[model samples]
Target: NAGVTQTPKFRILKIGQSMTLQCTQDMNHNYMYWYRQDPGMGLKLIYYSVGAGITDKGEVPNGYNVSRSTTEDFPLRLELAAPSQTSVYFCASRPRDNEQFFGPGTRLTVL
Candidate 1:
Protein backbone atom coordinates (compact mmCIF):
# COMPACT_ATOMS: atom_id res chain seq x y z
CA ASN A 1 0.00 0.00 0.00
CA ALA A 2 1.12 3.55 -0.61
CA GLY A 3 1.59 4.97 2.85
CA VAL A 4 1.76 8.64 1.92
CA THR A 5 2.41 10.58 -1.26
CA GLN A 6 3.43 14.22 -1.82
CA THR A 7 4.03 16.27 -4.96
CA PRO A 8 5.58 17.91 -6.84
CA LYS A 9 8.97 16.62 -5.72
CA PHE A 10 10.37 20.16 -5.92
CA ARG A 11 9.00 23.67 -6.24
CA ILE A 12 10.24 27.24 -6.60
CA LEU A 13 8.05 30.10 -5.51
CA LYS A 14 8.42 33.82 -5.76
CA ILE A 15 7.95 36.14 -2.78
CA GLY A 16 4.18 35.87 -2.88
CA GLN A 17 3.30 32.86 -4.97
CA SER A 18 0.79 30.40 -3.54
CA MET A 19 0.83 26.62 -3.84
CA THR A 20 -0.82 23.57 -2.48
CA LEU A 21 1.19 20.54 -1.39
CA GLN A 22 -0.84 17.45 -1.94
CA CYS A 23 -0.84 14.49 0.46
CA THR A 24 -2.62 11.21 0.26
CA GLN A 25 -2.43 7.83 1.93
CA ASP A 26 -3.82 4.47 0.96
CA MET A 27 -3.44 2.96 4.39
CA ASN A 28 -6.62 4.51 5.70
CA HIS A 29 -4.85 5.85 8.74
CA ASN A 30 -6.81 7.92 11.20
CA TYR A 31 -4.03 10.40 11.83
CA MET A 32 -2.18 12.53 9.30
CA TYR A 33 0.30 15.38 9.66
CA TRP A 34 2.20 18.08 7.79
CA TYR A 35 5.74 18.97 8.79
CA ARG A 36 8.60 21.10 7.57
CA GLN A 37 12.30 20.51 7.95
CA ASP A 38 14.91 23.11 7.29
CA PRO A 39 18.39 22.07 6.30
CA GLY A 40 19.97 19.95 9.03
CA MET A 41 17.02 20.52 11.36
CA GLY A 42 14.45 18.35 13.01
CA LEU A 43 10.97 18.10 11.57
CA LYS A 44 8.53 20.65 12.93
CA LEU A 45 4.87 19.92 12.82
CA ILE A 46 2.73 22.39 10.87
CA TYR A 47 -0.64 20.73 11.19
CA TYR A 48 -2.32 17.44 12.09
CA SER A 49 -5.64 15.79 11.79
CA VAL A 50 -6.94 12.96 13.90
CA GLY A 51 -9.59 12.05 11.39
CA ALA A 52 -11.60 13.38 8.54
CA GLY A 53 -13.04 16.86 9.16
CA ILE A 54 -10.90 17.21 12.29
CA THR A 55 -7.85 19.31 11.58
CA ASP A 56 -5.66 21.21 14.04
CA LYS A 57 -2.64 23.46 14.02
CA GLY A 58 0.71 22.36 15.31
CA GLU A 59 4.04 23.87 16.34
CA VAL A 60 4.83 25.68 13.11
CA PRO A 61 1.58 26.47 11.37
CA ASN A 62 2.27 30.13 10.71
CA GLY A 63 2.55 30.10 6.92
CA TYR A 64 0.54 26.99 6.20
CA ASN A 65 -2.93 25.60 6.49
CA VAL A 66 -4.30 22.06 6.13
CA SER A 67 -7.56 20.30 5.56
CA ARG A 68 -8.69 16.73 6.20
CA SER A 69 -11.72 16.12 4.05
CA THR A 70 -11.26 12.37 3.61
CA THR A 71 -9.37 9.60 5.36
CA GLU A 72 -6.97 9.44 2.44
CA ASP A 73 -6.06 13.05 1.71
CA PHE A 74 -4.72 15.98 3.71
CA PRO A 75 -3.43 18.86 1.63
CA LEU A 76 -1.32 21.82 2.79
CA ARG A 77 -1.95 25.30 1.44
CA LEU A 78 0.64 28.01 1.40
CA GLU A 79 -0.66 31.50 0.63
CA LEU A 80 1.47 34.59 -0.03
CA ALA A 81 4.56 32.55 0.59
CA ALA A 82 7.73 34.16 1.85
CA PRO A 83 11.42 33.35 1.78
CA SER A 84 11.22 32.13 5.34
CA GLN A 85 8.87 29.45 4.12
CA THR A 86 11.56 27.86 2.03
CA SER A 87 11.99 24.39 3.45
CA VAL A 88 11.31 20.76 2.74
CA TYR A 89 7.77 19.79 3.55
CA PHE A 90 6.77 16.26 4.46
CA CYS A 91 3.48 14.52 4.70
CA ALA A 92 3.21 11.84 7.36
CA SER A 93 0.80 9.59 9.14
CA ARG A 94 0.48 7.10 11.99
CA PRO A 95 -1.91 4.33 12.69
CA ARG A 96 -1.11 4.83 16.35
CA ASP A 97 1.18 7.48 17.88
CA ASN A 98 4.79 8.64 18.06
CA GLU A 99 5.70 6.48 15.08
CA GLN A 100 4.99 8.02 11.71
CA PHE A 101 5.91 7.27 8.11
CA PHE A 102 6.87 10.18 5.87
CA GLY A 103 6.56 10.96 2.22
CA PRO A 104 9.62 11.53 0.03
CA GLY A 105 9.05 15.32 0.54
CA THR A 106 8.30 18.49 -1.34
CA ARG A 107 11.35 20.74 -1.57
CA LEU A 108 10.12 24.32 -1.68
CA THR A 109 12.37 27.25 -2.45
CA VAL A 110 10.94 30.72 -2.00
CA LEU A 111 12.92 33.62 -3.33
Candidate 2:
Protein backbone atom coordinates (compact mmCIF):
# COMPACT_ATOMS: atom_id res chain seq x y z
CA ASN A 1 0.00 0.00 0.00
CA ALA A 2 1.14 3.53 -0.61
CA GLY A 3 2.10 5.15 2.65
CA VAL A 4 2.03 8.81 1.68
CA THR A 5 2.39 10.71 -1.59
CA GLN A 6 3.19 14.36 -2.32
CA THR A 7 3.01 15.97 -5.76
CA PRO A 8 5.07 18.49 -7.72
CA LYS A 9 8.29 16.99 -6.37
CA PHE A 10 10.01 20.30 -7.16
CA ARG A 11 8.69 23.80 -7.71
CA ILE A 12 9.92 27.38 -8.08
CA LEU A 13 7.52 30.13 -7.12
CA LYS A 14 7.65 33.89 -7.40
CA ILE A 15 7.20 35.74 -4.17
CA GLY A 16 3.52 36.32 -3.33
CA GLN A 17 2.33 33.46 -5.53
CA SER A 18 0.44 30.56 -3.99
CA MET A 19 0.25 26.80 -4.46
CA THR A 20 -1.13 23.70 -2.87
CA LEU A 21 1.01 20.77 -1.79
CA GLN A 22 -1.00 17.65 -2.26
CA CYS A 23 -0.85 14.66 0.06
CA THR A 24 -2.67 11.38 0.35
CA GLN A 25 -2.31 8.16 2.29
CA ASP A 26 -3.69 4.66 2.02
CA MET A 27 -2.67 3.53 5.47
CA ASN A 28 -5.97 4.37 7.06
CA HIS A 29 -4.19 6.24 9.81
CA ASN A 30 -6.08 8.74 11.88
CA TYR A 31 -3.14 11.03 12.57
CA MET A 32 -1.83 13.11 9.69
CA TYR A 33 0.65 15.99 9.86
CA TRP A 34 2.41 18.61 7.76
CA TYR A 35 5.98 19.58 8.55
CA ARG A 36 8.65 21.78 7.05
CA GLN A 37 12.35 20.91 7.09
CA ASP A 38 15.05 23.44 6.52
CA PRO A 39 18.44 22.52 5.06
CA GLY A 40 19.85 21.07 8.24
CA MET A 41 17.08 21.67 10.70
CA GLY A 42 14.72 19.11 12.13
CA LEU A 43 11.09 18.82 11.17
CA LYS A 44 8.86 21.66 12.30
CA LEU A 45 5.16 20.94 12.52
CA ILE A 46 2.91 23.20 10.45
CA TYR A 47 -0.46 21.54 10.93
CA TYR A 48 -2.07 18.23 11.78
CA SER A 49 -5.35 16.39 11.87
CA VAL A 50 -6.56 13.58 14.03
CA GLY A 51 -9.16 12.47 11.51
CA ALA A 52 -11.47 13.66 8.80
CA GLY A 53 -13.26 16.86 9.87
CA ILE A 54 -10.81 17.39 12.74
CA THR A 55 -7.81 19.66 12.24
CA ASP A 56 -5.41 21.68 14.36
CA LYS A 57 -2.66 24.20 13.80
CA GLY A 58 0.87 23.22 14.67
CA GLU A 59 4.02 25.07 15.67
CA VAL A 60 4.63 26.76 12.30
CA PRO A 61 1.18 27.41 10.96
CA ASN A 62 1.93 30.92 9.76
CA GLY A 63 1.65 31.34 5.96
CA TYR A 64 0.13 27.91 5.65
CA ASN A 65 -3.23 26.25 5.97
CA VAL A 66 -4.68 22.74 5.72
CA SER A 67 -7.96 20.91 5.28
CA ARG A 68 -8.87 17.28 5.84
CA SER A 69 -12.17 16.74 4.11
CA THR A 70 -11.58 13.05 3.58
CA THR A 71 -9.78 10.24 5.39
CA GLU A 72 -7.09 9.88 2.73
CA ASP A 73 -6.32 13.42 1.64
CA PHE A 74 -4.71 16.32 3.49
CA PRO A 75 -3.61 19.18 1.28
CA LEU A 76 -1.58 22.20 2.41
CA ARG A 77 -2.31 25.63 0.97
CA LEU A 78 0.22 28.39 0.85
CA GLU A 79 -1.19 31.90 0.66
CA LEU A 80 1.07 34.75 -0.40
CA ALA A 81 4.19 32.65 -0.32
CA ALA A 82 7.38 34.25 0.87
CA PRO A 83 11.09 33.53 0.86
CA SER A 84 10.79 32.44 4.45
CA GLN A 85 8.51 29.69 3.19
CA THR A 86 11.21 28.23 1.00
CA SER A 87 11.76 24.82 2.47
CA VAL A 88 11.03 21.14 1.99
CA TYR A 89 7.47 20.35 2.95
CA PHE A 90 6.64 16.86 4.13
CA CYS A 91 3.41 15.07 4.81
CA ALA A 92 3.38 12.32 7.39
CA SER A 93 1.14 9.96 9.28
CA ARG A 94 1.30 7.68 12.27
CA PRO A 95 -0.74 5.03 13.88
CA ARG A 96 0.74 6.52 17.00
CA ASP A 97 3.72 8.69 17.97
CA ASN A 98 6.05 5.71 17.83
CA GLU A 99 5.59 5.06 14.11
CA GLN A 100 5.43 7.95 11.68
CA PHE A 101 5.86 7.65 7.91
CA PHE A 102 6.86 10.61 5.74
CA GLY A 103 6.22 11.43 2.11
CA PRO A 104 8.88 11.91 -0.56
CA GLY A 105 8.82 15.67 0.12
CA THR A 106 8.12 18.76 -1.96
CA ARG A 107 10.90 21.25 -2.59
CA LEU A 108 9.67 24.82 -2.96
CA THR A 109 11.53 28.01 -3.67
CA VAL A 110 10.35 31.62 -3.61
CA LEU A 111 12.21 34.17 -5.65
Q: For this target, which candidate reaches the highest lDDT against the unseen true structure?
A: 2
Cα displacement (angstroms), candidate 2, residue 97, comes to 6.7
The sequence of per-residue lDDT tens digits that candidate 1 reaches over residues 1-111 is 977899999999999999999999998889999999997889999999999999999999998888888999999999999999999999998897578889999999999
Question: RMSDs, each prediction?
Answer: 1.1, 1.0
The whole-model lDDT of each prediction reads: 0.93, 0.94
Candidate 2 lDDT, tens digit per residue, 6-33?
9989999999999999999998988999
Cα shift from native, residue 65, model 2 (Å): 0.7
Candidate 1 residue runs with Cα over 4 Å from true position: none
* Residue-pair clashes, model 2: 0
Give, for candidate 1, the lowest lDDT window spanning 10 residues: 93-102
